[model samples]
Target chain A: MRRLSALALALVACGGGGGPTHVVSGVSPPVSAPPAAAPAPAPAPPPSEDASVEVGLGEARLCVRVGGHVHCRASDAHGERPLLEEPAVEGIDDAVSLSVGARHACAVLRDGGVACFGDNAHGQLGAGVGVASSPRALRVKNLASADRVVAGPLHSCARVGGGAVACWGENGEGQTGSSTHYAEAARELVVPTAVAGVSGAASLALSRSVTCALAGAGPVCWGRDTTQQPIQNTPPAAAPWLAGATALAGGGEAVCQATRDGTVACRGSGALVTSMGPVALPPMTSFGVGASHACGLLADRTVRCWGQNYSGQIGRPRSEIGTNVTVPSAVPGLPKIKALAVGGYGACALSLAGELFCWGSYPGAPREGGHEPSIVAIR
Target chain B: MRPTQIAAAVALALAALLDRGARACSCFGPRPALVSPGPDHPAPVTSRVRALVPIHRAAGATVVLRPPGGAPVAVATASRSMGGVDLVELTPSAPLAPDTRYEIALHSPGQYPSTFVFGTFRTGATRDVKAPRIDAIGVAGAHANPGAMSSMCQSADTVVTLDGISVSDPDRDGAEIALGVWIADAAGRVDTKKLPVYWAVPKNGHVQLGRTSICDPRELPLPNAPAVTLGVAAIDESGNTSPVKLVRVALPPARHP
Candidate 1:
């Protein structure tokens, strides 16, 4: 059987002729000098080809895939220079997928190679160095031809060739798939290590303390089980329910899987569902989970989300929509969504036309303004 | 034996076992060995005493310190658990007098009828003149790993580390001294937040403070700031404050490819 792949195309569009446009929204200015020479102008788009863009949310930065390159901006401090403009962020032209964690980000290149930047205190960058952090995209060691990459709060993992998974960074609760107790010593796993007992995996999903992979056998997860929640450190002996799951997604303390039958099974925080009860869900093609909320893209191209709606992450105010949406509700005022990405308290949807619309909150200052879906302009 | 007789015997045995368990007292610390003071053998003086006890059974326990010829000094207690060990720290409202003896007491209502004496320690000759020496101040990026992700959110500050700051005290044990830090950013904003300083027991002779990132509420936000200056001061047990020592750090310029 062909493996199910979360291969949604991210759209990118070049701006009209301009010198060097900088976009700032309560962020700080770039600390490094601008490039000595301007980059070559991007060619105009052909009528038949839509620009592809990939977006990832970090703790305080928003990364957008543009022209096969990834550019990032912060949402809190005041200044507006793209993080990719740094000299250290070279060889990002072939980035195919991007995953952003609390303080770092990783991009899967077209050749299935991986590179990461930002905080490396625990060596999340996978670079064999002692530096606490880096602005450059360091190539992940011993990892090549990765098809999918997911960045957890601290560690990062990638599904490499042969459906094998490799992980690095904090492994306190065995999140890195290493039995060694590193969290006790306050140490970190600096390089990607093969995840034991996991192969033929199609994709990986990470929460605060747990890592789950949709493998041939089923959705296998491991890591710290501090909450005694259904999402335990060890998979149940007999989990027929997980059979034939195509994709896995989670945030905060919850985990949800989309099955081939098009139904969704979620465990952890009950807030991810609606109060009306578990209604029959439409066949889903994609799924995204944030800290307290979850969203799914239907095969019909419509998007629906549930869980916490406090910040209007479900696309409406809590007054209009209740606090706990136990049932999946369609997100209003959105075009045909191609893909979706969820952050700590906010969610963003990429439209078929390559437009990005976000609701709730991203990294930065607290949510002070209205919580509504608004267009985010990217270059 | 009759069923009633057997049941009575089992109840008696269980009650005896619980009584023995309740009477077990496992407590230690206050460090430097609390003992009588002498001119040749002076005791280390501090306004606070930290005691290690069973965390689960310390709910109604109280600690008190009585100075010679003076009313009992007010003691505040705080409890914390680390590495499976629970610690209860007792801090006196005021420092003990120099060259004076103070009796320490622990009282648990149901566990002990009378106050349990923790022994007496005499304070040494006042050394309020010498303040703790600030050895060095070091800063590094916050530790980024999967475990730290739950609490931190994304922001422009993503590229910047939270700036973990470490300070060392040369005179007394690092934990014995109360240290306060002030951070000033390039924007000229000064934050005089009193950060917690933990003594490096295994490392010996060093104290560490601050988090991996400024996102922690206790840390001063220094995102994209080109430079920062930190001021540190040590407050002695006798309420003598040290002169502020300033350390200026020049951060790498923000990157723009």
Candidate 2:
């Protein structure tokens, strides 16, 4: 039983100002505990709560509404926080989102279209041309609307009706699909069309070119197949290194999938990751990808992340992994996190309470500093 | 319970709680902050700056640039007292002269506190010179059909020298030598001597590549096989030649079955 060191505990405590260190007492033993139940329905009117989601946007400010919109603000040398907000309109309708490249942000909309904003230098924004400053909605032309959208460092994707998937932006290593020629459009992948025969693609795991989809059975990924990170698509036959996956996320060079059996498997860049072992899963619900780390939202509405935190991506440390936290560490003091997003060097979580708490860089903002706000009740 | 036994029991209970807490807390979490190094001196230089920053702030902390054996040239200064964080860009009052040795001293309040960055970078000397000299010869590399490859280098026996003199500098309000390179076969020629590579999806989320998938390397995209050499070159503001670098990769030896 590895325990969080005193320094890690201090850092964690410093990260979140409110809340005493909790010691779970009577909770079911992790060995046989069932995944947490699905979260309750969100409240109306954007949950008069505090900001439940906060991220350290690159030279940008971040804010989120529990079951609502996610916003990022950045200035041009001048001190001004331009509002860049995108709202989620689906049941639990909050479009889980994350930042990519430098200033780009993408969100999954209720209508199944990916809404993107910020720098489009490499056309990474996906919201083709005519810059969208204030979340002006747009969709991929000639592409089916998606049920969810996952944003990578320089590329983005949306799961369409059926098991079909389309991606645009950078495709250096054919991570988007097996296409040989690069096309910057919502191009269809007719052959090997379905991601691992996924009858219903629910989410996308993107790492620049490589994209993995979470289906009913497990996770299936395509593009950029290396030895440590191979691409397999045989059906019925569960993929090696991928099974019981309910949610998936891609960060830096590694990809992590949440298994229904309450554990996680990650590969790429050869970094150590957390294993649930006999621990119970809270039901894989949502996940986000950062530059080199990933975070997931559980059915209980709590948040957990693994991988590097050189810039505080996984908040304050909890175990010996602080110097370079390789495995998943439970974020201290956060309660019932509704949705989550990961960016270059930071992560943000939207709490069911509608209070937006953030950990990592850009911690000077009075209200949105890295901690749960006791005063602001989200929903 | 004895004192030691009681203490041991407490420790065990705490460990159990910690384990449960660890798993319970493993559902989802937050991202980190933006801490990527912007433009800066190399890593070692940055480390030096961090170590020496505390002493420099005695007086208003500032960075003063001085040229080799010349009067102090106040190129850039720190507006605010930085806490040794790496500075992204130092907008000098004027661009430094090319091919000159310059010393950058980050002035903290105390004299010993300041750290000096020393380097000699040549500016646009090559720009003032004529375009890059290209020695294009008949098909010298792999070609199963010698006549075919030779035909590609038709007429022009002499290498074309794309002079940097004609390069334009848009920012300086005029043209600065922006010399590029390309190959021209007898049948066709490149419109511009520039690299065609574009942005692509990040491989592993870092290495920059074209956004699209890779196509057949042999299949040329241009309408005609515009003989393009390997890479391109650019000159600086000063008259410094940017090391006439060539991009024409040597073709593999041709094999005939």
Q: What are the per-model DockQ values?
A: 0.02, 0.02
Candidate 1 is graded, for docking, as: incorrect
Q: What are the lDDT scores of the predictions, listed in order?
A: 0.51, 0.37
Tell me the spans in candidate 2 whose CA falls farther than 4 Å from its real position.
Answer: A1-70, A75-102, A107-113, A127-138, A181-199, A216-218, A228-238, A270-287, A296-302, A317-321, A362-379, B1-257
- Encode model 1's per-residue lDDT on A1-379: one tens digit a residue: 2244333211110000000001111111111112345332222222121145566665556677654577776656444333445222555777766777767778878777898888776667776554677777888888887866777667778888767778877654566675432211112225787887777776566665566776656556767553455534442122344455555665655555665455566554435532333334665545667666766666555778777777676777788888777778888888877656666666677787767777776643235633667777653
What lDDT tens digits, residue by residue, belong to model 2 across residues B1-257? Answer: 01222122112212121233333211111111011111121111111110112222346655444453246664432222112222222334544454443443343343221322222112332222233222221222212232322212111111222222222333332222223233434433443323322101111112111111111011112112223353333332222223344434333232221
What is candidate 2's DockQ? 0.02
What lDDT does candidate 2 reach at residue A123?
Answer: 47
lDDT of 2 by residue, A259-356 (tens): 55666565544332332221234554445555555555554556676666655657763243464555556777887765454555566555655455
Against the true structure, what is every candidate's RMSD?
22.8, 24.5
